[model samples]
Target: MDFTFSTEELLIQQMAREFAEQYLRPATRRIEKENRVPDEILAGLAGLAGLDLFGMNIPEQYGGAGAGYLSYVLAMEQIARVHCGPGLILSAHNLGLGAIANFGTDEQKARFLPKAASGEHIASFAFTEPGTGSDPKQLTTTAVRRGDEFILNGAKRFISNAGYQGPLTVFAIEAESGVPTAFIIDKFCPGYSISQPWEKLGWHGGDVVDFNLKDVVVPLDNVLGKIGDGYPILQFGIAYGKIGMNSLALGSTLAALELAVRYANERTHREQPIAKFQAIQLKVAEIAGLYESSRWLCYRLGFLANDPKSYRDFAREAALAKAVVARNAQEAARISLDVHGSYGLMQDAEIARVYRDAAMGPQIEGVLHMQQIILAGDILRKR
Candidate 1:
């Protein structure tokens, strides 16, 4: 494999780096303390939109930049280098756009993609219900057709990006077929309300809320893909979501590793820099290796996206990537904190927040064990 980024990819990565330094780095402390994102994603989204980014991985015909998966991943990694908050905001919005781009009718595309491309609107996806997380087969959200509209009734929790008043792509079972279907509903639709904001451990800058659809009305034209085809659409969307989340892992891990290496060299112990110590050396080596492994996995997933045959294989790989990178990043962050000694625990120290975010790795995307089940399924399929 070439293992080289294209010009576009490099440019986007550079842009992301700059975005993080200016917008994210300066605000990390405040965002964590205030527990609000300050509409943070909007700033980055507007900037990227100028570069024709917002829906970059989607096709141009769908009002995206058509920059390909690798370019998007490169940008996402850079943005995530600072913190998971902003990157997650963009990621969740993209997931909503991807579902529409991949499955929506031309009219639906014409209506939503243009606004999405320019960052004029953001989006959120709702799938996980109050009772269901992993097993979605028992989803109780039902959509019944009534003339030109569909009436929806259900509730979903742990939904990111739902705090925004934008288009929401919700998954519900069609009343007649009892099969999962997706619909695009306006946030202002009557009977659609988000539950009170939920406090979270990490990712404090972004919004996380529960979404409820009580006899919500959705136009039949907004149905994404065929009725009962939500399973595949959901899979395809989350496959990319997994890749994006783990890419954040790679970026955060890189930050942690860099911080540790720098701290080891600058910190003094016994009248000598801690870099002189073998223990510090081992920690740096472990972190660098782990980061490199997880990062390469992200790049591979980006490339695999170009090949249709690899998608089935890619889904399992994506799950593994999320799980591995989350674990690896947490380990790297812990060692980095240890290298900082007691200073790392101080709220004034930036690494303190990075440490907290890293500890949240297993919770992002999906739990580590659940992802392992996907890998196990792949193994059994091979047999």
Candidate 2:
């Protein structure tokens, strides 16, 4: 397999790098402090012709850039390298949007994709509930069928982008069949309301909040895939979601490596640069190794996503990649912090922010142990 990026891929990567450096880097502090991305930044990100980032993975027929998953991964890494908040927003958006793109009817695609691709609305996926932690069997949400609509009632927790005006793919159990199903509902509909945004440790501007659906009526056509197909749909969404998560972790690892190397060169120890120190050199080398390893794993996962042999195989690979990359990012960040010594502990330090962001990598999307379980199960089954 060739390791080189195509010319178009390189261009997309360069565009994303420039955008992150020019726009996101300057606003990183503001985003972190305010806990919100500026409307101008969001508009620029979506409206820019060469950098239609929100639509990278969407097909061209849906008014997206149609850059494919590899292009999307390249762009996400650059974006997250400067600041992860925007990356988080894009990742969660795609998590929901990918589900619809892969499973929705043409009519549903026609209705939802254009606006979402244009960033007039941001998409969200809802699966987790107060009672369920990655367990679909424990879902308490209920969907009751009526003449032409299904009335939904449930509470979703830790949902990202729930406050955004767009399509939200929600999972609930159908009352008649007692089977879980996925539904597409417009955000802030008559019976939809969101709680205050949850204060998160990192990725500040990427909003996460609790939301309630009280008799939220969804049209019959909005049922994604088939009735009682929520499990497969959920698996597909989570698998694709892991690709975004891996990209973010890889970016964080790269950032941490860069920060450590820069600190080593700039900080003087005994009237000489700290790079002269073997301990500092070793730490830098370790961080670099982590970055490189995580980078390839993330890129490979993205490539696999473009044309997977099977969803089960793709899901297994995604789990493996995330388990390694997320933990590597966290380890790299910790090593970078050690390189910074006491200064890293200060709130004003850049490495401190990177540390916090890296800390989230292993926890979000799926916990580390859960990823282990997925991969382990796959291996055991093969045996």
Candidate 3:
């Protein structure tokens, strides 16, 4: 892997960092407190720096930067270090667009990719149902084939972009054939509704929509891939998405560590800087180790993403990266809070927000035990 970034990469990194410091960090607390990312704010941010365009891996022809995984990862890191909600929204939109750009038919690409890549139409991926957590094959949502339309009836709980507000790519099992399929369901679809609002432990500003589709009619042209082929497409898309999430978590943890180090160095302990204390030195050292390890793992995953054919073999690695970084982030946040003491717990402090937000990592996206199980299975298979 090349450690050097081209001039373009450096410029993108600097640009993203400035956006985070200027717009995202200033409003991070307000968003977390209100638990709402106003549509106007989202739109303004999308317009200002074209946050949606830079982090996307889609091609320039599709109105994106045509950047690489590392570029996206770096941008995600910088944005998430201050505010993961905006970062997640951008990531999900890009992931949805990436899925279609890579797998969709020419017409599908021409229809959906441009709007999504340009950030004119936000994209959301709906795969997880209440009945099916990690297993797509067991999805209870059913799509029945009609003449020129498929009638979709099901409920999707804990969806990222649930409201019909955003353009959606929904996955449901075709009833007759028992095959998973992806559909481009428009907001005007007859029987689609966001039934409930979900509040999460972290990432408060992002929407966690619950979709209820009752006799929803979707045209045959909306099918994302060949019949019975949506499972692989979704799996591949989510693998890359998880890598981006790991990058965000690692970046947040590093930011927390930096905050802690600064606090320790300037903080006075018996008329001398607390940096002189061996305990503070040890804490900083441990944080440095955690950040370095997580960052390297994220880079390795970026390299792996460059060649997707190798991803199947990397499921365990991806799961491991998610688990390790999630755990590392929470630990780092706690250390930062402890080092800062009272100041860290204040709502105005960045560490407090980072502490609250670090937990969004491990909840559903490859929990530690799940990753351990996968890693153990890989070990046994290799042995």
Candidate 4:
């Protein structure tokens, strides 16, 4: 396997890196501290870079650039390297689009993909209910069929883009067939409302809120894929999404390490840069090693996602990548913070913001414990 970037991939990666440094880096700290991301900022990102809804893996026919998974992962890594909140929003858009690109019928694609790809309508996913996290089969949100439309009556918590006043891609169980299904619920839908803003420890740039669907009626044409196939559809999209999240964690690790190294070189102790000290050198080396390892694993998973035949086999690999990288990033952030000394903990410090964001890594995609157990179970069962 030739794990090398082609000229095109390199160019794309460079473009993403430039955008990250120029557009995202400067305001990332402010976004985190203020805990409010202006809608105009998000719109500007989408408009300027066309990243608002760039689903790199989706075909151009559906408004995507017809890029591959590797390109998508590389772009995500660059974006996350600058700021995780926007990175996550981008990741959610890709995941939501992937589901429709892979499974949605022509009508479904016609209705959403063009707008989703162009960032005309910011996208979101609603799977985790009030209590259902890992066990989605226990979902209580139900959709009862009433002639031409289905009445959706349930609430989803911790939904990204919850109050953004845009279309939302929702999942619920159909009452008649007891089958899980996906639907596009526009913000104008009467029963849809964002209840409250969720104050989070990290990822403040990404709007997180609780949504209530009180007898919201969605047309039958809005259903994604088959009536009862939402489970596998969501699972597949989430597996890919986890890869993107892992890339986010890896990118954050790289950023933290670079920041620490820079700080160490500039700060001197006893007429010598702290970077020259054995203790600082050791921490820097550790950070480099962890970042390199996690990054390669993330790339491998992205490449493996190209073919659907091996997707199931990649589930454990994806989960493991997310778990390992997230933990490594959390540690890297803390160590970087320590390297900065008292300044690191300052409310205005970027490292402090990164430290807070890093704390969220292990909990974002999937719980580390569950992922580790799943990896072990997959190994034992294969044996």
Best model number under lDDT: 2
* Model 4 Cα lDDT, one tens digit per residue, 126-243: 8878887666678888999999999999988887766655457788989998877888778657988886678888877777788889999999888877788788877777787787
How many steric overlaps are in each model, in order?
A: 0, 0, 0, 0
Per-prediction TM-score to the true structure, in the order listed: 0.94, 0.98, 0.92, 0.94
Candidate 3: what lDDT?
A: 0.77
Candidate 1 per-residue lDDT over residues 51-73, each given as its tens digit: 55567777877677888777777
How accurate locally, in lDDT, is each candidate?
A: 0.80, 0.90, 0.77, 0.78
lDDT of 1: 0.80
Cα lDDT over the full model 4: 0.78
Q: Which stretches of candidate 1 lie over 4 Å from their true place?
A: 44-48, 51-53
- CA lDDT of 205 in candidate 1? 66
lDDT of 3 by residue, 1-383 (tens): 47887797777778778877877777877788787765654664543237654236877776766777767777778878878877667767766776787778888887777766666677788888887767886888889999988999998877775552546888898877898988887654678878655877777777777888999988899888888878887776776677777877887798889998999988997899888888888888888888988888887877677665665676767877887888899889888888898988887788887887887787655456767787788879988
Q: Could you give candidate 2's per-residue lDDT for residues 1-383 as a string of tens digits?
A: 79999999999999889888987888999998999887767775443323787777889999888888999999999988988988888999999999999999999999999888877789999999998768889999999999999999999999999988999999999999998999999999999989999888887898999999988989999999998999999989988999999888888998999999999999997899999999999999999999989989999998999999998999999999999999999999999999999999999789999999988888777778999999999999999
Candidate 3 is scored at a TM of 0.92
Which structure among the candidates has the greatest TM-score? 2
